[model samples]
Target: MSSKDYYPMETKGSPKSYSPHKNGNLMDKSSSEQTEKFLPVIEPGLDSLNKNPEDVDFIPVDHTPPDRYRLVFFIMVVHGIGILMPWNMLINAKQYFEEYKLGKNETEVVELKGKFMFYLGIFSQVPNFVMSGINTFCQCGGQASPRRIIISISIMIVVFITTVILAMVDSSDWSVEFFWITMMTAVILNMATGVYQNSTFGLAAILPMKYTNAIVLGTNFSGVFIAVINIICIISAPDPRTQAIYYFVCAIAVLLIAFDAYFLLPLTKFYQHHRAMVRRQQNTSGPSRSFQETCALFGQVLKKIWVQALCVWFIFFVTLTIFPGIWSNVTKKDFPIENKYWTAIFCFLSFNVFAFLGNIVSEWKKIPGPRFVWIPVLLRGLFIPFFLFCRFEVENKVRTFPILIDNDYVYIVGGVLLAFTSGYYSSLTMMYGPKLVEPEVAGIAGMIMAFCLVMGITTGVNFSLAVASMAIQ
Candidate 1:
C-alpha cells in the first residue's frame, strides 16, 4: 500500500481527518493532503541529511504532546516528597523520642538515650537498603506498576497512624517498652518507604529527565519542610508529646494527598503518552520479563551506568556521614544565640533551604557534565573533615584535636556549600544514570542508581558512628 492509502487525507468534506500518533498526538491530515511532512527525531551525531540515518526514525512533529499545566511533573514531585516523608517525620521529631519517651530517669537517659538514635539509624537504613535491593529486581521482573507504590504508601500511613496514637498515650511508666515499640514502628515505616521510593525513581526514569530531577527537588523540599516545622516548634515551645502528635499527623496528611495525586497520573495525557513510547521502544505489549531476561538486562544496564551510580553513592555517603549525626551536635553556646536556635537555623534550616535551592540550580545548569561529575562527588569528602574540625560537642569526651574552624560564620558558610553540592550533584548524577542506558531498560537503570543511593546512606549513617567516636575519645 502507498503512504497515501495508509494515511489518507480529508477531501474538503464534512470534518477534518486526524490520525493519532503512537505517542497519542493528533496529526491534522487536511494541512498535508498534497505532501507528507517529516522531522528529524534523532540526535545529530552520525550523518546530516543522509539517505539513512543511523538507527533513527523520523516522525511528524505533531507526535510530541505538551505537559498540560505541568500536572505530571507536579505529581511526580509530590510523590518525591512522599518518598522521604516517613524518614523525615521520624528524624525531625527526635526530641520526642530521646527526651520524652526514653528519658524518664537518669538511668534510662544513660542507657536508652544514645542507643535510641543509634538503633533508629540502624533499623531505618538496614531494612530500607535491603528492601530497595529486593524491590529493584522484583520490579525489573515485570511487577513494576502503581499498585506497589499505592500499597507501600498505605502501609506507611498505617504505621504513622499507630505512631500518632502512641505519641498521645503516655509511656513514661514503661519507658523501656516504649523504646522497643518505637523501634518497631521505625522498622515498619522504613520498609514500606523503601519500596515506595525505588518505584518512584523507576517510574520517573521512563519519563523525561526533568521529571527525575523533579523527584530530587521534591525530596530536598521534604527536608526543607521538616526543618522549617522544627524551627516553628522550637519557637512555639510545644510539649514533646504535642509536637510528636502533630508531626505524625502532618505526615499522614501528606501521604493522603500523594495518594490522591497518584490516581490522577493515569488521566494525564502527557504521562500516558511517554509511557506508551517506552513500551513501543521496548517492543513489548506489556510489562513482562522472565527472571533470566531481567538478570541479563540488569547486567547490561549496570555496565552502562556504573560510573554514574558511583557518583550518586559517594555524594550521599559524604552527606549522611556528617549531617545530623555530627553537625547537629556542634554547639555555639559561647555565642549570643541559643544553642537550639543555632542548630535549628544553621544546621537544619540552612542545610535544607540551601539544598532545595541547589536542586533548583541543577535543573537550570548541569556544570562539569555527567562524565566528570565524579570529581565534585569525590571532593565532597572534604565536608567530613570540614564539619569535624568545627566545634562539635562530643558527649562526655574532651576533644584531643583543637577546633580549627571555630568561626561560626565560616562554619555556616561551609554547611551551605555542603548542602548545595549535595542537592546539585545528586540531581545531576541521578538524572544522568537513566539516560546512559537504552529506553527499554532505563527504568531498571534508575532502580540500580536508587539502590546504590540507599547503600550510600546506610553505610554513611553507620560510618558516622565511627567518625563520632574517633573525633574525640
Candidate 2:
C-alpha cells in the first residue's frame, strides 16, 4: 500500500479520502480534520532570546526528583546515627582508659594500653580512607543499582551485628589479650563498615547541591539526637548492661537502613537502566564518552578549582585533628562536675548544639557574607589556647559539700567558642566541598575530604599523646 493511503494526515477543507482496496470504506475527513487541528504556536522574539536564554522556550529537565530528596535525607539520618556512635565512645574515652589502667601493674603496660587505643583509632581509619577512595571511584552520575544497594545494606547489617557481638563478649571479665583482640575486631568491623558509610556520604554530596544545607543541618541534628540518647542510656542504666541497649538500638537502626536501601534499590536501578539506554543511543548516533573520559574531564575541572578544594581539605583536617585532643584533655581534666557520664553528655550536647546553631546562622539571610563560615574555625583556634591555660582547683574534702566551686570562666567561654567553631566548620565543609567539585565527581571529592579528615585524626591522636606525656613528666 502507498504510505499516504496507510497513514493519512487530515487538513482543513479536505474532502473525504479512501483506501478501499485495504479498508473497504472511505474515512470521515471532516471529523479527522477537526480532531487533528493544530493549536496556535508561540515563538520567542529575537529580543527575548538576546535578553536571556531562560526567556526562550525549552523543555524543563529535573535532574533531581522529589523522591531523591527523601532518599538523601533518610540516608543522611541513618549514616549520621552510625557516625555519631563513635562520638559517644570518644566521649567515654576517659572512663575506658581508667578501666584499662586498673588491671595493668606497670606504668609501661598502662601506657601501652593507651597507645593501643590510639593506634586502634589510626587502624580503624585505614578502612575509612580506603572506602572513601572506592566510593569516589564508584559513585557518579546518580548511578547505583538496586542489587548494589542491597549488598551495601547487607554489609552494614553484618558489621553492626559483629560490633554488637564483640561488645557483648568483651563486657565479661576476660583476659587482657582477649579483650584487646575483641576490641580490635570491633574496630575492624567498624572500619569495614566505613566503606559503606563513606560511600553514603559521597553519594549525599553528589546529590542536589541545593539540598546540601538541609542534609548538613539534618546530619548535625541527628548526631546530636543520637548523642543525647546515648547519654541518657549510659547515665540512667546501672552498669555495663546499658551497652546492650545501645547495641539493640543500633540493630534497629540497621534494620531501618536495610529497609531504606531496599526501597532505594529500584530507583537506583531505574536510573542506571535509563543511563545505559541513553548511552547506547548516543553510541549509535554519535561519539560516546567512556566513564574514564568522564572522570578525566571531571579531574580537569577540579584542577582548575584546586585552591578551594585544598582549602576545604586543610581546614577540615585541622579542625578534626585539633578537636579530638581538646575533647580528650577537657573531658579528662577540666569538667567541673564529678560524674564522668554527665560530663560526657554535657560535652556532646554542647558540641552538637553549637554545630546545629552554626548551620542555622549560616543559612540566615541577614548574615549576607561568608564570615559566618569562618567564625567556627577562628573560634576553635582561639579556644585551644584557653583550654591549655585555664584551670580550676578543688579543695575542702572534710565537709560533705565543698566550701567553694572554683569555675574557669575562660575555659567555659573557650568551650562554647570551640563548640560554635565545630558547628560552623561542619556546615562549611558540606557547603564548600560541593561548590569546589563538579556534581559528577562530588563523591570522589568528598572521599578525598574524608581521607584528609582521617589523616588529621591520626596526627591529632599522636600530638595529644605526646603533649599529655610531656606534661606528666
Candidate 3:
C-alpha cells in the first residue's frame, strides 16, 4: 500500500493480528500457524516512531570518523577525565596546594602534610554527595543542548585562570582570601564534575552497548592519566609549585579537547542518522513523555532489574569508600626502589589500570557480570580493614593495624582486586541492565543504570568518612 493508503499494522487491539504477552508486549499471532502478518514483539508506545512497525529506523552500525569506535572512546575518556581529574589533581597535588594556597612554608607543609592529605580526602567527597541530587534533576528535565560541556568548559577556564594566578603569586604575598577562593574554585569544579559525566553517560546510552563500554573505559582512563602525571611530576619536578602549574595546564588543555570531542560527536553519520530520526519522530509525534511518564513507563522493568541497579551502586560505593580517599594515605616508594609519591599514585594507577582491563576482559570471558555479583559486593566491605592495616598515621611511616599485612605489596594486591572487580562487574551490570526490557526502553534502562551509578558514587563518598574512621580505629 502507498503511504497515504496504509492501515499501519502497529495499531493495537486487532484481535486477529496479535497475541498479547502477559507482559505489556504484543507479538504477531500467525507465525506459528503459517505465513502470518504478525509483527515483532515491541513496546506499545514505541510504534509512534513509525506508523508501520516493520520499518523501525535502525541506527546503522557505522564505525566511521566522528562516530568511529575510537572517537567514541576518546570522547568518553575525556568525559571520564572531566569527571575525576579535577578532584584528583587537586587532592593529589597536596604539597603544592598546601604551600601555595594555604600559605604554608616548606617546613610547615612537611610538618602538617598528613593533616592536609586527610582533609583533602574529606573535601573531595563532599561534592559527590551534593551533585548526585542535582544531576538527577538535570537528567530528568533533559538537556535540550550540550550545555554540560559548556558549563564544564566555562568553569574549567575560570579554574585554569585561578590556578595560573595561584601558581605565579607568592601565597604569603597574596591575600589569604585569594588562596581560599582558588581552593574553593577547584572544589566547586570537582563538585560539578558529575554534571558533565551524567550528560556523557546519557549520550552514550542512546548509542550501542559498545559505546557505553567506551564511556566506562574512558572514565578509568582518566584516573590512569592523572596518576601517571602525578607520578612523573613527583619524580621529575624540582618545585611543587611548578608541578601544580603543569597539572593545571594539562587539565585546561584536556577540557578544550573534551569540548572539541563533544562538538564533533554529533557530526558523525552514526550520530547524525540516529539523531535526525529521533528528532523527526519527536517533532511529528507530539511532546515526548514527561519525566513522570518515563518513570511510570519503566517502573516495572526497574522492579525486575533491581539487582542491576544495586550492583551498579554497590560496585561504585565500595570503590569510592576506599579508593583515592583512604588508599592515597598509604605511603610507598617505588616497589623495589624508593621514589617520592610513588606509593599513593601507584596505588591509584593500579586501580584504574586493572579496572580498564576488567572492562575489556568481558570480551574474552563469557561471564555474566550481573549474576552473583552482590555476594562479592557485600564482601568488599572487608577490604576496608585489610587496607587499613597497611595505612599509617605517622609522619614518616607506621602501620596502624598489625593484625594482617604490614607490607606495601599487600596494599598493591588489595588495590588491584578492588579496581578489577569494580570494573568487571560494573561493566556487566550496565551491559545487561538495558536487556531487562524491550528494545524501545533500552535507552531508559541504560540511563537508569547510569543514574544509579552516580547515586552509588554519592553514597560511597558519604560513607567514606565512616569507613576512613573505622579503618583507622
| Candidate 1: tens digits of C-alpha lDDT, residues 1-473 | 34443222333332222222223322222333232233323222212232332234444423556888999899988998898888888777777888688776667554667645556777788899998988988753332456778889999999999998898898878888888887888888889988888888988888888999999999999989988888788778668788788788889999998998877876666765565445433432223545665566577678889999999999888988887778877877356787657877888788889989999998889998878889988989999999899998755567768888888888888999999999999999999999986565678888898899999888888888788778767
- Reference-based lDDT, each prediction: 0.77, 0.46, 0.62
lDDT of 2 by residue, 302-417 (tens): 56444434444445444444444434434333455666564455455666677778767766532323334444344454443354443311111122223132344544555566
Which ten contiguous residues of candidate 2 have the minimum total lDDT?
392-401
Could you arrange the candidates by lDDT from highest to lowest? 1, 3, 2
**C-alpha lDDT of residue 213 in model 1:** 93
Clashes of each: 0, 2, 0
What RMSD does each model have against the real structure? 9.6, 14.4, 6.7
The better-scoring model by lDDT among 1 and 2 is: 1
Question: What is model 3's C-alpha RMSD?
Answer: 6.7
Name every residue pair that clashes in candidate 3. none
lDDT of 3 by residue, 216-317 (tens): 777777777877887788779858888889888888887778867776775456665544333332233234555664455556557757898888888888
* lDDT score of residue 339 within candidate 2: 60
Residue-level error in angstroms, candidate 2, position 187: 3.9
